[model samples]
Target: MSHSMRPLLPNSPNPPRIETSSSSSSSSQHRTKRVATPAACEACRRRKSKCSAERPRCSVCVERQTPCEYTTLPTETHLRAQRRKLSNLEIRCQAYEDLFGILRSRSEEEIAQILQRLRTGEDAQTIVKTVQDGDLLLQLSLKPEFRFRYIFPYSGEMPRHLKDAQNPYIRSLLYEKTVTHLVQPPMYIETLKEISDESQKMYIAPYHTVELDDPRISSMIVSNWTTVSSDNPMLRMLLQIYFVFEFPFHPCFHKDFFLEDMFIGITRFCSPLLVNAVLATAWHGYTRMKNRAEYWQPHNLGYRFLAEALRLFELEQETPTITTVQAAAIINLVYNLNGIDELGWVYTHKSFGMAQKISLFTPNPEESTEWQMVAGVTAWCLFNWQALITFHTFQPPVINDPPSRPLPDVDEEPAYYGEILVKYPFGKEPVRIYNGSVFKAISQFRVILNDITKSFFNPSRTYSPISFEAAIEFRSKLRIWYEDLPQPLQARHIVLPCHLKIHIHYHIVLISLFEPHLHTDNAYNGVNPDMIVSQSRICFETLMRIYYLRHGFECLDTTLVQFLHLLGFSTLDEISVTENGSAANEAIRSTLMLCAKGLWEQGQNYYLSEAVFRMLRQSMSVEDVTILGDIVEVEDGDGPLNLMAQELRSRWPIGAFSKADDSKDRTLEHFIHWWQQYSEEKAQDISAMEQDGPVVPPRYPQRYGT
Candidate 1:
């Protein structure tokens, strides 16, 4: 306590007294006192000014009207007094020095902050450390803002623009740090506490790291890339596109936080390879870029971006990161979309291999960081993606075990962030509802689908006994899943393309499951031909709505094409058995026409669709096939999609369809000629059947495991 604040005793000869109080001490002549304090500012003494003293003045000192103090050292709490006075003097000295600095006015905010700290009684050393560690003050110290870009490790595939940088940042970049793959997942704060507290086992490790510090790569990257991000303009634009269009279905990474991390340069979730891979996949969404048609071309901007990611993948393969797996998976998606199945499968193996090496399949939620839980959620997504593709393409999945991780808490950001905005896709007023409701729903549904894949489908067809009861069991689970879906995601309520896609996918999977059992089962008469026809009609109508609404853009997707052609194959089978004008026949015809039109529409976006459409036509009579092609286009309709299709199809790779003599001719006439030739050949086979006692058609491997 200061002398003025100390209690006064009436008996004391020199009792401390307030000047305002009526007392004998006040009437006495105001006596001067001499005092000294430890660590008083020498600078202030030299200047002959009052310095570093903020304590209240005594009554005698106030009555004497002194401007400064001359006192003996503080007698009480002497040690504490010395430290406090010393810290105060040091802080004041810093303030004085900053006041005359050449950049004094520029650091007004920083200096004011320091003064505020002093007033708040913070220790001097802490304030100094804070200022030293922070960049804001250092930045203000420069005339122009200092450029403090970080050099990220580059692969041989570092974009050609930024090699051989001579800056200090590259010196650190040249040090190849052997890092583990601990890719963070999309996490919400609410679900974090539910995560397991178990420590991760370090037994399984994806090892190997090399110094990727090629001076050439540094030059190529120049100053374009940062520790967590690249300066690519396309990275930002395509990322938004991927989230808006693709993320709703997959929900692979947490969209909002992932974007925030990219902007603020957080390294855990976002990486250079992942960014480029995302860009490559999102390239399909770049429908109207300067009137160019580079959908599947090797030399487009997105492909070049993939080329960079490819090199990075090789460079980072030995020491795989969570983002490396993500990048590889996305690259697989792009390649598969373009019908590069071998490369797509190759990358799938690569991605799945990395996932295995990192023990991503092993659930270790104990003592979990939010990122680990996120990785768990993301693991589910990647496993589903890998499983679905593998099952569809006749390859068994390598990632067999499902991860047991905490579910994303849906109510966390329930109101904001993920509101779905459906526009022209709907005829009524658009609905805007929270999108996160479906994420958990999709994850749960994929779990069942993964089970179905392991049970029935494989390259060897090991589970051969096509049990009608088992199919019914699987179908029951599907119904239960649909019934349990959130209200907005249900039929008549779904508005977004992402929601509609799940519905269509459900019915398509049902069709594939039931189609093979129809011919050989008397015990399973529950699945009649009419039932199959109804499902086909549902898929056709739902699919056409998606295409015509300008909402769905899976036109670049070959898997959707596979589904479309599967419906066509069923429609053809129906045509052989049903008479014209019958309900089944009429259903078959509508399904066939819509399927053909869908192929034609999808072909406008990708050349492969046109060839696939005509190939289906060769199975029907010329008169019937021509009728399928005579349908009118949707009115005032698909304006955006039509433009995208036109632009995308404007240029094609030289050998897009096939390198036949007439390959260059993509005109309708050339296709018709080809279809007619195939039809005539089929007719010749029919003629040979009369003599050869029913010639069998060319064999196709069993489409369904049955």
Candidate 2:
């Protein structure tokens, strides 16, 4: 208490020490030098080592002579985490680059203004709205007529107003003529009385029944009776094939009644025109299946029957029954299939006229359903024929008046089985082919084709080429149409032949829609060359698919010819313009060659096919010729094939050269010379035949029956 207690009062540092026992001394020493925990340094944390608490630097880091830094934030220890951070940085850089790229075209002042607005916290949507509501946008919304005035102030009605303004001199002359006519009791009145008796005699004519005995009708009657009685196997097979393959696609008759009449030997009940037409079609189908060229002969049985059918058709032209009109349409189809487009058009026109004369479009309600069905079928046949001819000729349809009657419903179930129905093996199956659905699809396509013609190829609108905008719109509609087709009409559900045909037509429509753009140069039209190439590839690829499937020849008709023509020209154009050959270009060339050879081998006698074949042969590059055999020069006796070749040479001179080689020109010249020689020979033969009253080829008997 004397020294320690007195010194501990205020600021004495050395007066607090006290003495204790050994255990107490140890506890007091521990309390005086207590240690606290500290966070690890960055180096120790990364190295996974414990650190000794020290001033400014940790012991472990100091001992290792590494930089020591303390931090509260955690350090990434996994490789994946590092990668994620790097990826985020890269994405930010990319976004910045894209933003700069988009603004590269803008003026620096504009970009600066935009950045300033963003920095100032202006809303992006509000800025955009302000810009859109500017005066420039408002002016752009005004009508073109209100924005610009014509140089001439004349109104459209000025000419009409001038004509309507009456002249005083003309009115005075009219009044004088009226007065003169009243004073002079018109001399023409007495003259008219004197001629009235003559007019009556002229209007009246003697009526007499012209005794016209048609030998073909007599022959048809005899043959029908004999053929039915003998049960000719060839005739039966031919009829079976006709019913199976042909009639199903085009059903114009009541199958049960037609078969009953044929089998029961009911001469009075049967139509001579229909019978003869069936016989001719059967003969053709039989010959085609037999792979014979006999049908080409003028005196062949098919031709004979066709001639007799025409004779009967002409005899009853004045009073054309439904059967007569149907028979005529069938005959027209036969001609079309045979590639005689002119003759087909002639017969089609005749049938359409007959349909109109008989009011087939407006049928009587009192008639039986069978009669209504026949009338509907006849109307469809006419529509189909007109659509085909119009597409092939690139002309407006002749029979443009829409049918007054509605098309047969696709959902109408078949009730009875007759000759045609019996021939179909899948008649009872769930996925059977319905003629109604096919007709409806065809009707829809006809409507589209008519629209295309009227919009693009209208004769009245001479300057109207198809705009690219309109084409895209139409192409979308066609795609939807194909996609929305009924199950029976779809490619997967229908027979391969029918499926191929429907898709072929669809692709053809696509081609037609896009073809006009290939020649256009308008920037606003948005004509994409790559799109044209793609569509053309699809079209030719579809044709190649048909060829590989072996349905090429059977489906060959004028449409096929027209499609080939388009393909050949488009291929030539692509080859000419494209300097560096691509795989697509080569594939198109090879496919074109295959199509040409296929059409040439089939030899359907279509002028278009022959022209296309000749053109491809002449236009092919030497390399193409080597890959697809050398152009075979044949002495074809058909008419001039040079028209297409000359046209091609005129349109695309670059097609004559292969990568700027002169040898291609020589090859083209040589082929052209050969074509010229063949054309000359054909002309001579035609002239000689005309002088000699037509050279009739030798006749061939019917293959099946006598």
* Maximum-TM-score candidate: 1
TM-score for each model: 0.54, 0.52
Model-by-model lDDT, in order? 0.50, 0.50
Native-structure RMSD, model 2: 35.9
Model 2 Cα lDDT, one tens digit per residue, 36-91: 43456778778988766464787887889999876432343345455767876864
Count steric clashes of candidate 1.
Answer: 30
Model 1: CA > 4 A from native: 1-235, 289-298, 366-369, 412-434, 457-465, 524-559, 575-590, 604-611, 617-621, 624-706
Candidate 2 is scored at a TM of: 0.52
Task: In angstroms, give how far residue 442 of model 1 lies from its true place.
Answer: 2.3
Query: Which stretches in model 2 have alpha-carbon errors above 4 Å?
Result: 1-231, 247-261, 264-270, 287-299, 415-431, 457-464, 469-473, 491-495, 519-533, 543-547, 550-569, 575-586, 604-706
Q: Which window of 10 residues has the lowest lDDT sum in candidate 1?
A: 201-210
lDDT value for candidate 2? 0.50
